[model samples]
Target chain A: MKRIFASAHVKRLFSALAALAILELMTGPPGSALTPTAGFTGSFGEASSFFGIFRTQRWVVFLFLALAMYAIWSAWLMWGTQVRAATAKAVSVPRAASRTRPVRWGMAVAVLAVALLLPHLITDPFWQAAMVEQIAVYVLLALGLNVVVGFAGLLDLGFVAFYAIGAYTTAWVTGALPTAAPFGIHFNNFYAIPIAIALAMGSGIILGAPTLRLRGDYLAIVTLGFGEIITIFANNLYGITGGSQGTNTIPHFSLHVGPIKYLWGLTPVPYYYLTIVFVILFIAGFKLLEHSRVGRAWTAIREDEVAAESVGINPLKYKVMAFAIGASTAGFAGVVTASQSNTIFPSSFTLQFSINILVLVIFGGMGSITGVVLGAIVIQTGSMYLLHTPPAGYQPQDLYIYLGALLVVMMIFRPAGLVPSRRRHREIGLAEKGEGHMNEVLTGDTP
Target chain B: MSDKIFDVDHVTLRFGGVVSLNDVTLHQERGEILAVIGPNGAGKTSLFNSLTGVYQPQEGTITFQGSDAKPMSVIGKKPHRVSAAGVARTFQASRMFSALTAFENIKIGAESHRGIGVAGAMLRGPKTRRDERTSDARTVELLDFVGLRAKANVISSSLSYGDRRRLEIARGLATGPQVLLLDEPAAGTNPSEKLELTTLIRKVRDEMGVSILLIEHDMKLVMSLAERLYVLNFGSVIAQGTPEEIRANEKVIEAYLGSTATETGDRS
Candidate 1:
């Protein structure tokens, strides 16, 4: 119809096709025999030969294939946008009234059932252990990072330092290090869990106590430095940390209670279950903390620190608590990762890992537990899946480009995220409504 | 001295070389509504800051009636510590947590004074639960008192300007202070809202039995609401007397009221 031709979609399609044609013309053919040296001669024969090659059946087929791919991509984009807009309209209905208790309970039960049966249902060892379970570690990391960035409104750029601390603590305790243990004693990974968490929390306090006074960008820079310092120490400290090679062959999680005796092996299913249990516990605890006085205080501080202080909420104490609590989760994740792999390297604790976890939190919707968990699952699992079985003609490394594009698109369209918390949604709505700017003007917070 | 709840003895607060409050001294009698009226740059806010420990005075001492009946020196303490010592204040600009519900804002003020620790909050033990329940009840009560019970669940930012001022008062009352300092409470309010605020200030003094130290530019409200007035011009008190006496003082009129007489010209 005439409408379709006049539509913005058609314009986009034409532009995309035009770009592809330009690309085809410039590249000539894939791995063509014509070399760059043939260009310097300015020979008419060579130029005509190149044009002749472009006119061939193979070149024509390649151009047509590119065109078809662009058409499919454009169609997919249009469909995705339409579906999202429809869902957004639907979500405007009051959420609590729509979902009755029974429906909510049923959803919870279904999710639990799925989580419980996941490893068993996916009997493929590679997918279950290597892909799904590995992604779960990142999920835990994302959830913890959410506490710091999402709940406390602290931009902690060095969260992975806690992860490194946790991993290194496990290595030290389980006697995985080539160097002698401090007390020459080895403990089970099960025992190392608590120890690692404690150590990580202790380090969190140490880092937070001094640096928490520095807010926003300053805090982020300090945390960044802390993370780098941790990585550097892990890389250089041979006697205590085993240096760049890192620690390996850590003891597995085992218990020796009165009648019950169990030792986890290289099987990923048990580790997966272990992680899920902790995740559930953290989610529950976080939910409680979210509604408690501490949570209210955090929210108040996040909104306005001076107001919070006037009401007697010490910004430092709550911020430090957030840091320690967030760090504990990262420590928990590190312990799980180390036990699962029976090794951890300094190289694994990179700034890129921190950024990846932050992306998961942002992608899911900060401050929403479900959002963070789902975000971690979707992004981490999707990336791992892509790496394991990349699409034809696409390299595994191309995942970053896709991720970058996804982030850009998400920021442009849905900045509140995939599953924003009620508070976050309200905040975003207020900002969009220009209330935030009005507030800044009224309060003389012009900067 | 025994009846005085807050005594500022020659307090001089300076920011670098610029003197904000130069040797200012005043005292509030227990359960009395007192007002400090002055021009725009008259150091009224600086005095409030000194009293609240936001800025420690360079000279002299601020004395508050402690639990032992003896007046204790409260100079140089932190702002939160000052609140803990039973001196609550509301800012000139309404500073309620804009994102929080009105109830939550009041609850924070109550909880801060209630002494619930992080461990107690997390554990939610019987004691913590009891504290929380009581605090919630108190928050509801304060909301009712402020006539904002209907808007308790509404976010503070969404409330009208008058409602935000009332919520700020409710939050301040939640701190359970012996004396409350209100900075420019009538600022930006319409005549009806100003009347409501004046009645609330009186009710706070008479019913709640909390001494009020108010800073105001509205001379009519100050003259009507305050039992006694402290007239300040250039950070020094020119006169301290009953409204009748302050109204007749030539020095007070020449220094302050002469310039802003048109605004307060209706006073007979």
Candidate 2:
């Protein structure tokens, strides 16, 4: 059945069209197309009059949510198979290789792409504001960590430390310190973001330095310690930090582009665009670095440090750099983190946060940015919507069941990552190194 | 051994009160095959360890390539650094990356020449991938040269005993080291395989342009492969000379002949 999809020319053509549509939506088609929306903005797309029936509204929301899932799934489909195609052809293409993949992809893109695009047909600001913000923040945070773990291969147990660092940097530096009236400093997220990045990197270096020599388990332990320390400090430091009570009335992101305050005025829309733009920038930076020499350096370190060092690679230095870079992503994440909420507590930077990022890396495939981006969306948003938002009467362990099942299935079937690194897919087999495969795709390949 | 390709001048090694090696000095020429034949605790492997920097000497210096320059004193140097300095060794048990395939293993072994780095490997685009391709081809070539081409894609653990030994040699040679150290080439092989090993060692010495310091217990194999031999009875060398000369030495006779020929086979 699956073979017919690849063997038949007509089916292949349909797949190619679907592939284009998927890429158009997934790659965003150079921004000329109308912006695709999901969640709330998408939820109200079909309704023209003031109010609609509960069923219609519910259906609209469901359609948009499905589209959102499609948007993420399409990217994974396109890049995932594309990489497999590239690698399978490395030695020779087996005629028995997967064939029905394209048909299924076509079916997926045809159904969902229309649903997502439907929202753009409307000009409702509220839904537009909601859907876009959701996608943008996710892409940004995921991409930041993509560089840290995907490219470098350092397993960070305390990535949320940096995320918290970014958030608090915005919170502390921009907002009042509760006793800042005497100091006379105005709150500004503009200054806070960069400072947050710097501070996160500084702390990243500190955390990275001592544990760089240790591999796997030991590195995980030290980073876990660093994360706990950050959370404790945030909790204990009452004078500077708000402590367990949390901070309030924090500012939002504001920037002026050539005398124009492009994304200003505390609104979700501007923050949405602001986040998307930064996500683009992070993606670009990560892409360039992955394709650059540094990306290869990281992969080699991951594969075999001893072998890498024997070939003149300075393992300690590169390992440390990986830790710092990965931490920096968390830091950047923090900046947006603080801004978006305008309030934060140490609870936000819990060990679970660290686990979430690690899960992102694992699911996405270690060493693959595209995989991480896909993983962050599907896992984070999926978990939030599915497990966290049940049809009422949700068990506390509902989230665990969904995540655990997917994780168990993924691990048993595809341990490398949902989307894996390119070279590792061939090197370590699919399940062990899929996430890493995507990273390799993003970075190119070091050794 | 020819006149001094490696010169160990009274080099000694100690692990606390125990002396693993003591005042061992030996040399192998650029093209000759040398063997260190001894019983289990004769410090043959330890000699290779010192030369390759697995264990630093407690005292004394060693030199390579006929220079007055201070001996490289491999004693405290890291294993890889010592390898990069033109010495490569195999373990008593095959020390290899079990996860890596034969081709990948050799490619890793050839990493020294491929200019492979994390950055290069990460990019894995044209320049870096081309490097991988060329090196992989070279790895296949070396594997074929060592007659393990059929097992190139197989995991290191899955290979047969003879194939594993060949893979180890292939990995050692991938470094393109000036000298190759084989701990025991024929220790566990059948008689026919041992004979085949003799031809292979000679072929490696002749073809690879790498000298060899072999440690083995098979007197017949050792006497044939090694042009000159060093016989270690206890912790020190009992005799160092041509196989014929060592064969006729009194210490060699006392160590083996005095032990009674029947007991020698039982102990071995």
Candidate 3:
């Protein structure tokens, strides 16, 4: 291969390859996937599951998939003609040359480049494991919510219902039955994961069924109610779920790659790796889905429901799919939660968890996977690290200080998020322009 | 001159004791400029609203281009669907998407025809990407046609009053409808703009091969632009003929000018 990336002409290079090289040696074997060999008994299973495959031989498989995805994405981008060519042409030299958008190519490139290097410096196994797991959970939630909010233009305040469903599914299937003590299952958590996903998707469709007729506040309230219903069931159903007391003593995740064994035996490392792998796969799946006929139909409805329906797009059909696909995230999260902690609880899947995911979606900039990932880390980590890091005797009132400040700053300085949707920002910015544009620029009714 | 595009057979719209449309019968032919002219409170816009499916008539069979156009069954259908059925309408007020630029607003209406949906805009895949590009290109062409290419990026709200009207027309045209309904193209236009708009309306009809149905109270503009005129009085068609016939009609003169017309070209 030419390896043109080595040339100086490649101005802003991602150090992902370089970081992989050094970590490759530290991880013990070449050609091994980033799947770390960590197990239960208080080790970092999630973390290893996430980065382990990258460090070991299995990385090549993941990399190949990613390369294929990128190639497909690029070819489409290169070949597809723009509908906005009129707008582009309409934008004459003077306006096109305007020096707005202070943060463009250079800054964007720097952010991406730093993302490449930042992974290497993050060597704290505990923190790495936490980061990996956290990223996986949030990204997964964001994907599901994106289908509902971003594609369907439907706001779901109680999205945690699906998450709880997945968790309960995993717990019930992998552990014992309602009749059995402590709820023991014949199948393991790994096997339960797929079933949980299916259950979550089914639950998503069930929720979507009635709610499809509603809009705005009505929809939000219904989703919220659904979330409450799921949590309440978990707390009250002691026979199966252990009630509010919850279930404990769960199993660790285990996987085999070719000749090597990467067992996430109750370690945070494997759990983290597991979460990352799933999150990436989901993102790639969504990337494809977003472009598919179904995805566009969702967005079309999202933008303008009446407009979409006029074009023979039945909004209900696509709306259900969005709900189903989005809820699938919770299923994955459920398996991870059950396997890592060897326990399950209703308290874990609450309205707060739902809101946390929603915040990540908005803060990250909806419709952008990169934005979702970044939002997940920044907002979730900020809450986990900063707000949660209470001073010795920090009371409820005292805790408000940091949160209050963060809220104020977030509202005033960055209403759109750390990285706003480029299209959204531009639309809002340009909407405010024009001295006599209404009269001379374009044609419409005189009024 | 030809068969009516819309044949409203005795539409009797009653509201308790008051009858809004009292046994009204009207016709709008294909590929011709049909102007509905009347004073305020004469149900000029109401008739239009009824035709566009915003307000369903109580009793009427309005057959449009071979099918019943105005029926309560249209109540289930949405505004966009109505627009898609070869009928595009512009609001009397500016109802453009304020968030979108003037160019974008028009493009949206234009793209609404085939590829402006979420699926079309997202994923940047082959079909959607291609559709979007074509839609955008057509939007530019439409903008240019309407002489609003210069203010394409200006938000719909930020545009001057005249430009807003132009934008609305551009947007309506973007729907690619066979029928274009203008509520009042010359309502707020100055003499120069009015003259230009008159020319534009004619060009739109002649060049685009679409039917134009206008509602204008401007007698002079109506006289010059309308090949056929329907004079409305209190939700009823009192006179229907050419400008020359309408001028000579006793009922039209009495309804509009409160006097009987003695000649075909009588003024004042």
- Best candidate according to lDDT: 1
Compute the DockQ of candidate 3: 0.12
Error of 1 at A393 (Å): 3.5
Candidate 3 per-residue lDDT over residues A1-447, each given as its tens digit: 357767533312234334333332333222224434311111212334544433434346434544554555455556645634655677865455543455455555685565445445676655655565566577778877866765465778888988877777766775543535223435666787888888898888888987866766777889999999999989997787788878775556665658876667544555655676676667667766665545545544654454344434456767777777778777777777667667777888788778778777766766666677787877667655643453222333433344445545564666555666543344334434532212111111112
Q: Which 10-residue window in model 1 chain A sums to the lowest lDDT?
A: A438-447
Candidate with the larger TM-score of 1 and 2: 1
Could you tell me which 10 consecutive residues in candidate 3 chain A have the lowest summed lDDT?
Answer: A437-446
By TM-score, the better pick of 1 and 3 is 1
Q: What DockQ results do all the predictions give, each relative to the true complex?
A: 0.48, 0.13, 0.12
lDDT of each: 0.80, 0.66, 0.66
- What's the CA error at residue A271 for candidate 2, in Å? 5.8
Model 3 residue B124 distance off true place after TM-score fit, in angstroms: 4.0
